[model samples]
Target chain A: MSNANAALAQAQSGAVQRYGFTLGCALLGLFLFTGCQSGGQTSDDKAAPVYEEGQSLTMEGTLIDTRCYPLNKDVNRGLDHERPEGFVKACATACANQGFPVAILRGGETDGEVWVLMTVPAVLADYMAEEIRVQGTVRSTGVLIPERVETFSDGEWLTVL
Target chain B: MKTIFSLMLAAFLFVGFTSEKTNQVTVKGKLIDTKCYGMMHDNHTNDHMVKKGDKMMKMPSCATACAGMGIPVGVLEDSKPGNDVHVVIAPAGTFAEHMDKEVRITGEAPYAGSIMPGKVEVKNDKGKWVEVEVAGMM
Candidate 1:
């Protein structure tokens, strides 16, 4: 009878050990999977730092033709070029209509940053060289893909709906 | 652990340097206000366009107005179909007086397209291309 009791006790202990080992393996697998997945996600997020397509941006500034701005035609020697006459609305409109890419000149601390504006020429040409409000997307190359344009009138920016 | 850290550092440095590469190039082209140039192309038929007696005008006054009013000026490398490319000039202030004129530019070529100026030359009223001395164009 004592032998039988001892045999039964041994069998129970063996079963518990096996079950514990299996449980530990499963828990370890779950932990490893979760850890790797989270790690992969973080890596992917940092791999590329670029603007997403069609990301919306709104800005206020003067419209311009990218062709006739500061550096003129001497892009290589831009510092040596001279533009004495300031922003010309007529010329901006004409250039924008003639298929030159338009842009907005944003006032910065030291200089104005030109955000290349892209949209239907006919629509944007009317506001060329004008101080207007615009809403658009930031293209990967830092171009502004305007979806809406507005003008400041009577202390309010009226949307061109 | 030390070996693993060294391998990781090596990989990071490789990516940091290889990801960004710049190229230098020299381009010869006309520096013109893209607007006035295009109006000339359109035959100056409409009043809304820059015109001299219903013709596209290369008048400096028209070009100057456009540049001052925030018009971007660019270099038109070639007008040939399928080969024509215009690059918008940065720091538009430096080229203010050279609108609708021919100029030589040296600068960085974008990875795929257009050149940005580091140095510029424009023709004087005497038709001599003179290297301009600009102070802090940007």
Candidate 2:
């Protein structure tokens, strides 16, 4: 009777140890994940810094073409380069995926407008030169059309320098 | 012992993550040179004719008349003489109220063909230089 009681006591202790080990592993994994990328929002995921309004006045970014390259030329007349069909949608999707918008600056020259863009403003639909530096970390919530035509379709519509 | 270990790990993570910083960028350039020059100039140059005429008339408004349409039109400001003033702007709405004037615009340097604007700087109503467009544009 004494031996059996001792055996039972030992088994209970063993079970407790195993449970605790499992719990410890789980807790450690949670801690590690908190600092990792796929985990919930952490300080690492903080958005880009914001810019002040009416600050030192110059900003730039890539010149995004809003035109979709159509397989058929008949519809291309009114399409031109500027007011293309899916330009808005492509930039929006790219912005969402990248977690930022594209920022660009326009020079004063009419013929040779330079497009030097900074990241984070990639998603915006419209921007002007002086306005770029003033507004920082502002994800422009504007219009974006269908997704299909904006991203993958390529027709060489607008040329950017 | 186990509690101490977990606490230590938590502390380490907090320190590392809290130190992370965000990015704010600064960009600068003149809009004088870009590939979309042709379209931006054309739209502003003959916007009146494009809106009023039944036919699509380009600058000089003579093309429409030569096409046998004799459409009444208004002349936008002539583009700057020197190539140095050549800058491209975006779609028609970028210039706000002043978008129609092709003669001499001193406002935001709009991206010519971009669906979105990269930067904006134009003369305000007070006549002082500002980065944004003052009036509502469609």
Best prediction by TM-score? 1
Which 10 consecutive positions of candidate 2 chain A have the poorest summed lDDT?
Answer: A139-148
Shift of residue B128 alpha carbon in model 2, Å: 41
Off by over 4 Å in 2: A35-42, A45-47, A65-161, B1-138
Report the lDDT tens digits of candidate 1 across residue range A1-161.
99999999999998977766665565555555655666787797587446554577787776665556544533211212234555343665565555555566664212455666544344577766567788876543345556788887788888872
Work out the TM-score per prediction: 0.37, 0.25
> Cα miss at B134, model 2 (Å)?
24
* Candidate 1 TM-score to native: 0.37
The alpha-carbon lDDT assigned to residue B108 of candidate 1 equals 68
Give the Cα error of residue B35 in candidate 1, in Å. Answer: 3.4
Residue-level lDDT tens digits of model 2 in A13-128: 88877777776666667656555644445453355333331123323322332222111222221112222343233433332233222223233223323332222222333331
Question: How do the residues B18-137 of candidate 1 rate in per-residue lDDT, one tens digit apiece?
Answer: 544556567666654544444344311112254567775444365555555545555656422223334544534456677656677777653223455667788678989788764322
Candidate 2 retains true contacts at a fraction of: 0.01
Candidate 1 local lDDT, residue B21:
51
B1-138: candidate 2 lDDT, tens digit per residue: 467556756765785576465222222222221211222333332222333356654444322221122111112223441223222223322232333233223333233212223334544467555665422111
Q: Tell me the lDDT of candidate 1.
A: 0.55
